[model samples]
Target: MFPGSETRAGRLLVRARRQGVLLSRAFGGPEPGEALFARAPKPWMRLLPHFLALAASASLLPTTVVVLLGDYGLPGVLAGLLGVGQAAPLLLAGARPLSAWYVVFSTDVLTALALLLWGGPLDGAAWPWPAPTIVGYLLLCLPLSLHLARRTLVAVWLSTAAAAVLVGLLRPGHSPGSSVLLVVLSGVVLLLGGALRERSEAQRRLAEQETISEAERSHRRLLEERARIARELHDVVAHHMSVISVQADSAPYRVQGVPEAARAEFTSIADTARQSLAEMRRLLGVLRSEGTEAEGGGAGPELAPQPGLGELGTLVESAVRAGVAARLTVTGEPAGLPRAVTLNAYRIVQEALANVVRHAPGAEAAVTVALSADGSALRVEVVNGPPATPARPLEWHGTGHGLIGMRERTRLLGGTLDTGPTAEGGFRVAAVLPRNEPAPGENA
Candidate 1:
């Protein structure tokens, strides 16, 4: 080759590579070269390998170049070019690291062979690797330890040792002790690599287990919270319910000169109140006993799944039996609603129907359950038409808490409620609860 031809040739190759990149981009297709870039090692672990390679290449390349320039002149510059070539493997360590080592191993063996054929027979400390070989293998192995699987790293470690030994025993200048040292140092590189791989794997497993444990703890906390709410409110509400039942039962018996029709109406009120109290007691008992029941594994009876709108039929029948003619109509597919939405819907309807009986006895009430088209929310409307034939009802005075309870239930479910007298002198209670909303003030 001519003077400066090697540098010129290197520039030509680089220019060709860049031109190819432009053509690929212009034509609009994936670049194979980007495959190397895409798989680069993550940031924290990447910089060290490349920096070590840079230091090694800078140190060894100049020495090789000066020595060869004096001996082989232009040809010696080619040998120096090979020395500078160690940078390729170092830079590639952030991406295709193991590939770089394979290249380094082959190049060192070839460099040692070239020393025999062209640089003269092995005669000094520089026979096998010289400066470039030592740095190439050592720096390249650092990333291999971090990224490569254990079995692959072991194979590389063994092959590196064998190649060094073979180069020393076959070629003449190097002693047995130097070959042994090379093997020892190469094995240490691999051991460090394996240690890094194992530590990273262990950390990943620990993270996954911690996530699962946290989810389980969250679920348990929710159940305990619901139980706490049940324990606090059960007795207070139950007392009011019991009083309502007692009054509804004894009022007609105590009053003088009442018609058979009036007595039947009083009987209906007592029956409806008793049924509601029984159901509520069972539900609250489930909550109150949750802590003991879970611990003792049979300390109390198991309750059915929580009430939802599916129980609306039973509610409508109970309302009818209580002298208020009631029926249920569902609009939209319903598909289903969230558990909290369903439970609150049932409660809201129960309260509204009870109001129909209390405020407008013998009124015709229609309960409509309309799930929104998007299934994101549900609209419940309980409209009771005016009572049949105006008459004086039993001086009806009861706790003012019924409407308050309805509002509270609606608010906790993150829903809307509108209750007032209709234009036709009937009462209407309407609510719209969004699906899967967090229960206000407690777990849903």
Candidate 2:
């Protein structure tokens, strides 16, 4: 036992000093590190002792058989066969569960039967043949627990006692007193060894469970750290990006002699940047939280005066300002659309316009925000014509996370997206979102 591992129950079994010495040796001394093959079963170690017993029996059983049965070569051959029989169950078990216990039980029964037939210790005919029982008991002691092991120990003792009595009856001249004493002592040793092995097995299981629990806790902590970092980055960095965009839009308009077209182009550029920054921040915030906004609060900061279908023209104007020639068109009355639906519709257009600026710069684009004929849903679509030049800008880089982010947001709002290239050399992002009835205290 290590310094802190000693238990009150274990200490009570034997003398403190003697038990301490034995435990220290078994655990590999005070400074012992983990074993080289700690987790693997030592099958060879158990098999070695059984092999020795088989060799001893080869000589001992045959010599005794010659005396008891009076056959020269025949007695030796029979004795050798019986000796080999003892090892059969041990080899058959081969890493199977509870194999140690099965081997011990088989050995005990065989020993009792052999001793009964041999008459007594006085006959010396096959006295050494039962020696393998001790080896079997030691092998079993490795993996069985003390609580259940006691029952097996008792079984071995009863079998040994019965064999001793039968041998005394069979051999009339043998001293029954000494023979019985030896048999009782052997039973006691088997019990002690098994009890020690059982205690070790229980301790090993407890240690394994603790290790598993510690690993799980470590993994959970890592996920929490990532979420915290995401939330902080969204709150701080995304806010500054929005500020830069708003300032950029005002710059061109304030300058003198700037053409109306040039001023509109700069304003559009500012709108696209602000929109992209907002969407990214919301996405980062969503990733940081445990659940999505549809399950509770909105993605991030709530717009002071939220945009609805009425703002579709302004969105188109901003895209035009950014260098894309955008035209807005409406098909039906868009009144009474739910706030959630309106917000998602705005975001869909926003992301589409941002993709145009980033992926198809200086392209011609069109915006359409329409209410369904049944007035149950709102449909928003942004279509951008192909880029002007054959190759895109050198500064533009796409991480590929944007499309997935957009689709996730739409799904959360109970919407579906149909996005792909158009027949007229353009890309389109079309989404249809539901308008749920407002709950109490919610704006309609």
Instruction: Tell me the tens digit of each residue's lDDT in model 1 across 1-444.
Output: 011122233345446554444333332211223322232234433254456556766766676566544543336656766666654556666557767777777877777667656774344455566654675577677767766677888898889778877777775545665556667877898797678556645654454455455446545555654554454344434555677778778888789888889888888988888898789878866676434544455434333245566678898888788876677877775544545566667777876766566555545434343434235777888777776655445325433334555666677667788876678766667887777633223222
Q: Which stretches of candidate 1 lie over 4 Å from their true place?
A: 1-74, 172-174, 255-269, 281-444
TM-score of 1: 0.51
Off by over 4 Å in 2: 1-202, 217-221, 257-264, 280-444
Top TM-score model: 1
TM-scores of the candidates are 0.51, 0.37
- The local distance difference test score of each candidate is 0.61, 0.52
Question: What are the per-residue Cα lDDT tens digits for candidate 2 across 353-384?
Answer: 66666666545434333435236666776666
CA RMSD per model (angstroms):
22.1, 20.5
| lDDT, residue 147, candidate 2 | 25
